[model samples]
Target: MGLLTNLKDSVSRVTDRLFASEDPKRIGIYGPPNAGKTTLANRIARDWTGDAIGPESHVPHETRRARRKEGVDIERNGQSVTIDIVDTPGVATKVDYKEFLDHDIEKDDAIRRSREATEGVAEAMHWLREDVDGVIYVLDSTTDPFTQVNTMLIGIIESRDLPVLIFANKIDLDQADIDRVADAFPEHETVPLSALEGDNMDEVYDKIAEYFA
Candidate 1:
């Protein structure tokens, strides 16, 4: 079966057998390294909801384990909807752990070890297909959104047939070009916004509500 069909079947089974009124929605934020995945997550967590993304900028792979913040509510069309935003690790092409061999680290350095493994972009794709209810694919508007990494990520999301919202973040930067970024996801939906400055965030929230509605 197709990925979308599989997801629908999974959701259907859950709805049929589990708590009927649960209505728990999972929102996943995905992007390549330094594309502002955590920044956008913090923006949504702070402005829309009281939840916050823990301060982990200097810590490598902080989001690799799927950090979740609960109790997010968005006021759409005069109604309130609860949401849970999951801040995931930055997806990127694979890197060799052999690169770290010369660092003179012991085998017990689990933190450093785990970082080397998650450097692969495929790991994020695996997580998305497994646990995501919807995706906000953050695009670096300052750079080429059609780059190999971004394109591959979008293709995987499409293959899953999941509802994806393209967030053209960093639009406030000098190099940003929202128009070009929007063009990258012509097949999926797109929203241009500056996640850092909180510009156009309401538009993002509205898009999210419509996707699940």
Candidate 2:
């Protein structure tokens, strides 16, 4: 990491530690479609609550509505925090039934999915305004980090003044470049992990216990 990057991360961590609260917080799992938002949510829920929030699929817009797993108590080495995990629908600028058709979805189902996905986007934004304490923004590290979805999401999170911890998910992939994501958003903390393979999951638990506890 560059000196500037290192400095920003250091400052952010110190700030989080200084503001750490005792009460449980509602932390949303947010990101663009197919970026492992649901995967990460389920992993955290499974470990802390013995349950999964929602299902995940390679097909986009699988989660058309928000799913909540309440009272997830994450404890590590005596440090712990209880959180309500809200696994929201994927935020996307556009949703087309044709895209689903490309995945071999039936026409009727595709249309319904597209409609629900569009509604889901609006609902996710609503939660940001009404119901959230902190957020875990999951990003696909294998793709370009400088996209409209990512930029807009970061801006919204900043505008809300939320404590965000960005996860550079899918690091097990050969093309993943976590540094690009970290450089793109220097103000927040970024931890690289593969939720599918369960790599570096311990760090995720530790971060939640540290920052959210």
Candidate 2 TM-score to native: 0.89
The residue ranges of model 2 lying beyond 4 angstroms of the native Cα positions read 1-23
Give RMSD to native, each candidate: 6.7, 3.0
Worst 10 residues of 1 by lDDT: 54-63
Clashes of 2: 0
Question: Candidate 1 — which pairs collide?
Answer: none
Per-residue CA lDDT of candidate 2, range 85-200, in tens? Answer: 89999999999999999898999999999999999999999998879888899999998878898899889889998878899999999999999999989877899999999999
Q: Residue 39 deviation, candidate 2, in Å?
A: 0.9
Query: 1-213 in candidate 1: lDDT tens per residue?
Result: 377965775586445434534565778888876677888888888887766785545333445556687768878999776777888777767644454445554545644655644743455666687877778888778888877878877787878877778888887888999888777776666788887788898888888776643
**Would you list the C-alpha lDDT of every candidate in the order shown?**
0.72, 0.88
Ten contiguous residues minimizing lDDT sum, candidate 2:
16-25
- Candidate 1: lDDT of 134? 73
Q: Cα RMSD (Å) between model 1 and the true structure?
A: 6.7
